[model samples]
Target: MIYENDISYEIRGAIYSVYNNIGPGLLESIYESALDYELKKLGLKTKRQVVLPFHYCGDQLGSFRLDLLVNDKVIVEVKSVAELLPVHHKQLISYLKLSNFRLGILVNFNVNNINEGIFRKVNGL
Candidate 1:
């Protein structure tokens, strides 16, 4: 698995591409699609809107879809909100724990600079 700084660098590169070209005020899917392209251009495998099922006790609880899953190792959540909330970060953390993925990226594309809006999340699970 990659460390925080390395993964952060990968994310920053993606954010830089998206911000420099795409700008903001687009739909989450638009940003997601753009990120997918940029990450793919970097030669990283990426899956968009991946559905992850949650199990409770012994029964199936529900499922949540991640905006993007990169290299089958990192979860990427795209948002076009006015500002990122704690709940947004918490949601990514929960997704990381649920999917047993070690790292995740929460990116808000509603800002002028996506670099500032990019956050790295991790779960030991």
Candidate 2:
């Protein structure tokens, strides 16, 4: 298992709180909104739909938006799928690398148990 930092731990708690209240089978947007609200309620700074610009050899490339950036440290990707696929994990990893963030949490809100749907991804860990 990868080591989890304090920010990641707090974000995990916030994710669990949202999952416990909201349950499952909801759309990704819904979970995103609720998790943003929950993270703020926990006194954590959060930015939603944040655009992360990519760069290549001093050239500006297109950017991708992140679902949530918590405390400017952890990237939180919300998904409401039947199950999390490798592509989903890869997506988060790409976001983490682009954003220069070390930790990311991918939460799928379509599972019977939230624990089974939570994934912690680390970049260069």
Candidate 3:
């Protein structure tokens, strides 16, 4: 899998800007929308709430939605929980695995510092 550090840094910075503007405890949608705006402002291609289909053992397992997908290569998950639990990271990892994306961002907009809320490489980190 290709790991683009320069692009990753741009994505993280955009996510951080959104977190800084809309401090803590907002709904996931709020953060999702704000991040979408910021990412677009940075000229990075992104998609929001993309519905990805899944299958189980050749059977259709239905579809799953992602909060934000950046550059069609990274998944960005927004959370407003008090702390980013393991399950949150698991969800993002699952999304990357299921959607066949190589990487993801598990950004929890509930910490004192936005940097603390950023979890990079949800699928590999």
Best by TM-score: 2
TM-score of 3: 0.89
Question: What are the C-alpha RMSDs, in order, of all predicted structures?
Answer: 1.8, 3.0, 2.4
Scanning candidate 2 in windows of ten residues, the lowest lDDT window is 1-10
- Evaluate residue 108 in candidate 2 and report its C-alpha lDDT on the 0 to 100 scale: 92
For 1-125, candidate 2 gives per-residue lDDT tens digits of: 32348878888888889888989988899999999998888888899999978888988888799999888788899999997889999999988887779999998989998889999999994
**Ten-residue region with minimum lDDT total, candidate 1:** 1-10
Per-residue CA lDDT of model 3 for 1-125, tens digit only, reads 43556558888888778776768888888888988899889888889989988888988879999988888888888888887778888888888888777778788888888878888764553
Deviation of model 3 at 77, angstroms: 0.6
* C-alpha lDDT of candidate 2 relative to the true structure: 0.88
TM-score of 1: 0.90
Q: Total clashing residue pairs per candidate?
A: 0, 0, 0
Candidate ranking (TM-score, best to worst):
2, 1, 3
Candidate 3 colliding pairs = none
Deviating ranges (above 4 Å) for candidate 2: 1-4
| Candidate achieving higher TM-score, 2 or 3 | 2
